[model samples]
Target: MSIPPPLQLLLACLAVFSCRHFVASHQESGDWHCDPDDEARIAAEFRPGIVTLDGRADDWSNVDGFEFPLRPALDPDEDHQYKSGKMTVKALHDGKDVYFTLQVDGDYVYSKGDDHKCPSVALMFQIGDSATYHNMGGCKESSNTCNSTNCRGYEVDIMHFSIGNSIPGRLYGGNSVNSVGLVDMYSWNPHCRNIDASAPSGNDSTALNDWKGAWWHSSFSTHPGFIEDDSPYGSSAEKGIYYFEFSRPLRTTDLLQQDAQFSIGKSSKFSAAFWYPSDGNPWHGSAHYTISCDWIPMDVISGLTSQHKAASGNAASLFAFVLSTAAFCVSIFVAYMVSKNKSIPFTPIDDRL
Candidate 1:
């Protein structure tokens, strides 16, 4: 009634394989665990009208900050830059609007084709309940075309900000024009942008007109229901650290746009990337940027959570421990079987004796 040695070894191998598969699946899935050290947290202490859209970080000093390291673009051919850095982000929300302050330490490089010096940053958030891969949706395909609007299955709301280049001649200390920045915020929903008439068609002439009546220009004139404010803090001469503040209503009335609306108490997933252009067109130029990884799990509460989410957080450690222990036990069993088999020597035939 006992199992054979070979069979025992086979069973152990299968167990080891299962343990390995479990660990690999979790690692490769790119699922976002609400780890306090790995994932960034955004405090929900914003009050309407309390935060002025100024680039100053004085108001944000008390709030918690999350750090996201910048890396080269996932697609080297489409977009590539070698430079690396980190962006520190802080968030707050009034009942009506949400404000974000991002600070980075890098040289200010203006967009391409522009005469004045400038720099820009962008934030992308996944909209909806479905989970999607974070590498800009380029998981299954061999090519990097997953970034294209047609291949993506989920929608992302983008908040793009630029410093010192929105206006042309408004010089700041004769180096760059103006310190206050501009925001070109929009939603990237392939399903909606392609079908909705109010959404901007995929054409060069109407590209900036993603939303009806919204204009991408140097001035502050914006379309109705479109609310965003931005400002940059840093001297054109020093070019040291730069601080940026962006504010917008939590929910917009523009139903045609692929924007995400938020309630008072809920949770969402967001991913972010930054581009530092080197040459060519700022929008299309070759730039160094970061790879979009797992989502940054955020809670829509009045304050930051004292600890990570109980249900989803700490999964990485717990799962890893279980898998490792299972794998180790299987390995030990296999080794014991092999040793036992070797310890018993073969006996000579009786006729020869």
Candidate 2:
């Protein structure tokens, strides 16, 4: 019943012969099998907060990949008040459809009604900050902030705009004093007093209006990938996700749908940025925030694996475990061929009896 050590080693090597087949099957099947209920639960977990465990690597910072340690690490707005955390994400696919859930949480959420009166905080969950073209806010110079390829995306703003303060492109939005009934220590500026009211973005399309308690959502799609676009200044109209938040009742929610809606076999990392104020702390008032995500890939046209096996409808992780595997295989093949020269071909003796 037991195979010898030598035979076991021989069998272990047989795995190499089937690499191509495994790769093909894996590309089609995605991850293991899963029931529908499991998929729905995974989607629901990430929907309640402000985070991006579903987007490209650059969505957090100019960072090329999604490694938790590399994120901006949610520092205080300054070295003073709030704390934030790095975003973490995991995604999978099942070959038929895809779904993702994300969350961003902190000790305390900044009030939207506060509006940046004078030196008020500029809060937002903007996409494309990873690239220069998509990073531009209202006051930044240049329309498309990037010299490289431009990106088209959206953003969600949650800040304190007011009469006492002035943002680059907003008037009533930059000031939040007097509107939320704050102390009137300063002179009574004769301007709008409803900067941070619990309402939709001034009944407009801009993100600043949809202010929630402090969180918001804006889904992006079919835009340029970070792999192709990387700029420092932040671009405009390239492609990103941004949307203002509205007043929260008992609960709030949002969903993202891909425009082209295609999934890859390789495992893609997801990350996000959540910057807030940590009033009193050390390490430059470093803020500690928590973000999480779950994702499922869609199998609309292609099979779960390259061999075309049905993934039994179970969701497979987004990082389908393909790229690194292929690379390693290629390397091994090259090495073997090099070691065995064609000049040293094996010849059989002719038996002339």
TM-score of each: 0.50, 0.24
Query: What lDDT is reached at residue 294 by model 2?
Result: 18
Model 1 TM-score relative to the real fold: 0.50
Superposed by TM-score, candidate 1 places the C-alpha of residue 226 at a distance from the truth, in angstroms, of 25
Backbone clashes (count) for model 2: 65
Residue 266, candidate 2: Cα error in Å is: 5.9
CA displacement after TM-score superposition, residue 50 of candidate 1 (Å): 4.2
Candidate 2, after superposition: displacement of residue 54 in Å?
16
213-233: candidate 1 lDDT, tens digit per residue: 011222222223222223232
lDDT of 2 by residue, 112-210 (tens): 223221112222222223311112121232322411122223222222212121112111211222123111110001110112111111211121122
Best by TM-score: 1
lDDT for 25 in candidate 2 is 20
Give the range of the ten consecutive residues with the poorest summed lDDT in model 2: 183-192
